[model samples]
Target: MIRTGNEYRESIRDGRQIWIDGEKVKDVTTHPMFKPVVDVRARIYDLAHEEHSRKVMTYADEETGEANAIANRLPKTQQDWKDKRAAVELVQREAGGVVTRVGDETIGEMWSLYDGQDVLNEVDPRFSENIRRHIARTIKGDPFHISANTDPKGDRSKAPQDQDPDMLLHVVKETDSGIVVRGAKYETAAAYANQAFTKPTIANWGNDKLSDYAVGFVVDLGSPGLKFISRNGFAGRAPAADYPLANRVDEVESLVVFDNVEIPWEDVLFYRHTKAAAFIRSTLHRYSALPFVQRTLHLADLMIGSALWNVKQTGLEKQQAVQEKLAQLACYREGINAHLTAAIANAEASPGGLLMPNQSLLYTGRVFALSQLPAMMHTARELCGGQICITPDSATFNDPEVSPWLEKFYTINDNWVAEDRRRLLAFARDLLNSDYAGHRLTFQLFAQSPPFAQLGAVYRNFDWSGPLDLVKDAANLSEKVNGSL
Candidate 1:
């Protein structure tokens, strides 16, 4: 069930429509804007077959007696959760940067739906069997899966019918074989990924029983009517030496337009069921949040490393103030680590009999990691000093006439050479102060969901009755207060 890097590269050359900066992209595997991340994803597939990483990236499937990706396996035990985490960490480490939405992080959205088979059966019995088959297919096929949730909702004041009906993705027509959907979704990695579990964003489904908008299905990225309009990418914009991370790990986002694209009946997981849609929106990230929050943890480590190296090069670590700042960074890193570790340890059995990280702990961990990211980035920026922003580009450092003067000022000691110092500054600058840095920060802020929706997940998951019961017992309240509990 494992594919090599070349095999993966060949799979995405499906002649799908893709455009960037008004230029058509013929091959995502080789396009300058997409190749970096595409190769990262390709490496993920290759890692499962490599000797050094295969043990961690893959497992033996009992049903087929074959090697399948650990990332796509059903989480039936706690060890499975641990193995999934290890696989994702291996990919991030190998890529030299974090790249979310490749496969592991998004496959769990389907798992979340997998856990809702009962709801699916209630609407349509075939829908339950469809999800089961898809999950199994993902394990056997190991395609580059991604997610699609948000639509470019035109206006909030009016209903979807009042405004442009295309603002939300809906079932336009149903034929004998399948349903034809027409709308657009803003999906990361859609330009290069193989498929997407397209669904609706969180919405107020106010008292509706059934509607065309309450639809969810797997859309093949190579479908005839699909068009990928991507934003301008960061790669090839500057020298790799000056913007290494951007050039190597920028995952291009795209607006995937579905112009009457047909999703086969076998691919449809749910349809025309408001209850099913609401159920999915509530539990969309149940398993996926582990990988999503883990990305933040990786970012924290990078921030800490960049800041620590800058202070070490300048001999600033000797100062107590600098040491305290470094301590704060360490605290942030370990806080994320602790949350992730504890979530798995306290894992609970999901309704579908799969093991899920503790819901309260997991959702709160996501909130803690995302809410504090901005402040922590600011702290890391301050620790790196003002030089990260002011340092000259690599071209100036390599210039013949200016090299001597620049080297004299940049070199701090025999151990810290000018070239090394410049390199660290450039790295720190890209991590903390470049256009890529800003975009990454914004991506993390709203990647899983917006701030309000994130907090709402915490609200819905946290057990408020625990506090209420304690307060009532302490105050010796009447039985009426206990009635609600």
Candidate 2:
């Protein structure tokens, strides 16, 4: 069931239309903007076949004895969650940076729908069966799955019918074979990914019992009439020596245009059912938030490392103030670690029998990690000092005429040479100050819906009955108030 790197590469070369920077990418595997991340994904596939990583990256199926990716397997026990976490860690370690929107982080969204099988069945028994089939296929096929939920909703106040109907992706009509959809979705990694669990971004479905906007389906990236018009990629836009993360692991976002793209009957997970859409919207990140928040933990590590190294180079690590900042960063990092660890330890059973991370802890952890990211980055930037921004590019260091002066100024000691200092500064710059950094920050902010929606998840999941009971008992509330509760 597992595919090799070459096999994964060849699968995406199915003549899918992809455009970036005003040029149509001929092959994403070789395209300059995409090649780096594509190679990272390819390397992950290859890792599952490698001797050292095989055990961590994949597990044998009980029935067929086929080695399926551990990332795609349904969680039934605590060990499965731990293994998935380890697999993600292995990937980030190998890539030397964090890359979100990759396969593992997204596949869980489908599993969320999988938990809503009863709701889907209410709309159509076939819809529930479609989700089960897809989840099974993901285990057996090893496709690089991703998510697509947000659309370029034209105006918030007006409905789709009032403005551009294509503002939100919706079914245009139904054919004998399938339904044709016309609209665009803002999806990360869509240009190079295999498929997306396309769904609605609307959390409030209002009073409509059924509408065309209430649709969810598995969209094949290579389907005819689909166009991937991506934003300008960070890779190849700057010198790698200056912005390594950007050049190495930028996951390009695309406006995937469904120009009358047809979703085959088998691919449709839900249709014309607001209840189905509402169900997905409410619980979309039930499982995926674990991995998404985990990535932020990795980002915190990068910030701490970059800042600590910078301070050490400047001989400021021993200062009490400097130590305080480092301590704050540690707290931030461990705060995330604690939430992840506890969520797994206290894992709860999903309605569909899958084990999901404790929902309240997972959601609160997401809010903490993302809500504090900007401030944390700022603190890291301050610790790194102004050198990260004012530092000259690698080219200037290589200039023979300027090299001597730069070396004299940049070199702090024998161990801290000009080149190493420049590298650290460049890394810190890319991590904290570059345009890529801003984009990544924004991605984290809205990746799991907006700030308000994240808080809403926390509100819905956090148990309030215990606190209310405690308060009522302490105050000795009247029986009327208790009855009202």
Per-prediction TM-score, please?
Answer: 0.98, 0.98
| Cα displacement (Å) at residue 98, model 2 | 1.2
Query: Where does model 1 exceed 4 Å of error?
Result: 483-485
User: What is the Cα root-mean-square deviation between model 2 and the actual structure?
Assistant: 1.2
Q: 329-411, model 2: which lDDT tens digit per residue?
A: 99999999999999999999999999999999999999999989999999999999998889999998999999999999999
- lDDT per residue (tens digit) for residues 292-389 in model 1: 99999999999999999999998898999999988998998888888899999999999999999998899999999999999999999999999999
- Identify the leading candidate in terms of lDDT: 2
CA lDDT, every model vs. true structure: 0.91, 0.93
Candidate 1: which pairs clash? Answer: none
